[model samples]
Target: MGIIDNLEAMRAKGQDSALMRYSLGNEYLKQEQTDQAIEHLAEATGQDPNYSAAWKLYGKALTQASRYAEAVEALNRGIEVAEAKGDAQAVKEMRVFLKRAQSALDASG
Candidate 1:
């Protein structure tokens, strides 16, 4: 089985968690399946609201789907979480992505 299959099996066994969802989302993103990625990433963030990485990936998936407004929202939340956690790197990266989403929003208007 592939990575996704293995991850799904884990979930099937009631092993689901924020990290597992994040991994599944990351794998889906790697496959360019933005919808799947978004779904799992959203769950990841829901499962752990303080998960900066999940929020970042969720924002990225939204951005990839051209959901600029949602991307901005997620990224802003991720930045806040990262800041509170003193994760400078994550905060910086989310800011860059936030800028991209803002630019997309501007261009579409």
Candidate 2:
């Protein structure tokens, strides 16, 4: 079976967690399916509000979909969650994405 098939099986087994949703979201992002990625990533973040990785991916997916304002919001929240969790790497990475989103907004405006 494919990656998505496996993920679907896992989900059917009630193995739904933040990490599981994040993995599905990342896979969608890899395929450039931003809407699907956003849906899965939103689930992940909802499952675990402190899931910095999910938040990061969510922001990126939003940016890819040309939702600059939403991307900025997700990135800002991710940065805060990362900082509070002492995830230095996550914080740094999200900040870079946040700058990209901000730049996009500025360019459009």
Best candidate, lDDT: 1
Worst 10 residues of 2 by lDDT: 27-36
Candidate 1 has a TM-score of 0.98
Taking the tens digit of each residue's C-alpha lDDT, what string does model 1 give over 1-109? 9999999999999999999999999999999999999999999999999999999999999999999999999999999999999999999999999999999999997
Model 2, 1-109: lDDT tens per residue? 8897799799999999899999999998898878999999999999999999999999999999989999999999999999999999999999999999999999998
Q: List the residue pairs that clash in candidate 2.
A: none
* Sliding window of 10 residues with minimal summed lDDT for model 1: 52-61
Q: Estimated TM-score per prediction? A: 0.98, 0.95
What pairs collide in candidate 1?
none
